[model samples]
Target: MAAQFDKIAIWLVAFIPMPVAQGLGDCFHGDDRDFSSAPDEQRFRVRSDIVVSGFLAGDPQETDFHQCGETVKLDCATGEVLARETAGTDGMSFHHFNVGNTFPDPEGGVVDNPNEFCVNFLYDGAATNPLGPPGSPDVDMNVFFTIDPIGRMLSFRGATNAFPDYEAYASVEDGPPVVLFQQKHTLDPINGLPGGADQGVSATVAI
Candidate 1:
């Protein structure tokens, strides 16, 4: 999937509550769901640090079915994810992605901020969705993570160009938390027709 796109920019964003997929069962049920009591157990409830907003990526979006949504495996002691040649990626190193180049480096054309991290998904690109037709234009999305000096907040939004016929969903992590990310667009632009329309929402929540 990464091979098709020259680059993918990713970032952290907010979420809203959603319904569970049919037959998902109790696999995602957290033990200490009550907020007034155990809070640590709820940390796992985030399900994913990375939320995909496009058609979709790979299959098995769930975390081994043990947890809902997808998670980037962390090296627990160091809190770093490995850059390697993984399956379904066709062997591209995460370290080699063309990322963060578009970010503004100088303040008043002078200095660097040095605090921003990689929003790892594509800010502008049409990705290949697994469910899309063979060699087809699958997903179009954009994510800007505090690039502007005035606003240092995460922003994830997109106008997906695809032919799914059904509405385009902000391809979120598989088996997400109680909430899900979604966006709606008209059938014209994506389907090569007329009368374009797009709809989306964002929220800032305190944990």
Candidate 2:
């Protein structure tokens, strides 16, 4: 069954608490499109130093809650998660999230924060779900980060497969603790629609 955009918006504004897709779409549509003036693969380099991190959190709207309510066993060391619960008839489930451990950096190490780690799951070009097509049950995971002026970790959020699994998005080597992983938009591309331009990425860091 295909998930409708309106239903997803309801879940985002009412049920689920996190950054909603509609808001993101709005932000991207208003930002500048061409990062560099040069056409075709133009590079826009901005020199800046900051620490960043985050994780994934959320299930498809079409997921089956009944089947997802069960507990799924998994290894704590690696990020690999094995299903301990069955997917509901809708083929979707919600998972809880947590932060990862902290890592040690040099006195003044520069951590590059990409404007956005954009993932494009174009459903229009194919006959299946763009993020995780049919036969691929794994949820589409991601990490979003925000850093403070002093380069301290400010906030982090992302997705996971299990409801209560805290180790789903942590780094193998110890890193900083993450905040909450709430439901969010997996993949959306702005196409200069009537209301606004196609949704994209834009970020600003405070010094």
- Give one digit per residue, the lDDT tens place, for model 2 in 1-207: 211111110011001111121222121111112222111211111111111222222121222111122223333344234433333323222222212222222224534442222111111000111222244222222233333212322334433322111111111113332222233323332211112112222233221
lDDT of 1 by residue, 26-61 (tens): 111112221211112322211112322221232111
For each candidate, the alpha-carbon lDDT, in order, equals: 0.25, 0.22
Residue 55 error for model 2, in Å? 22
Please, what's the RMSD in Å of model 2? 21.3
Q: In model 1, which range of ten residues has the least summed lDDT?
A: 21-30
* Candidate no. 1 TM-score: 0.28
TM-score of each candidate? 0.28, 0.19
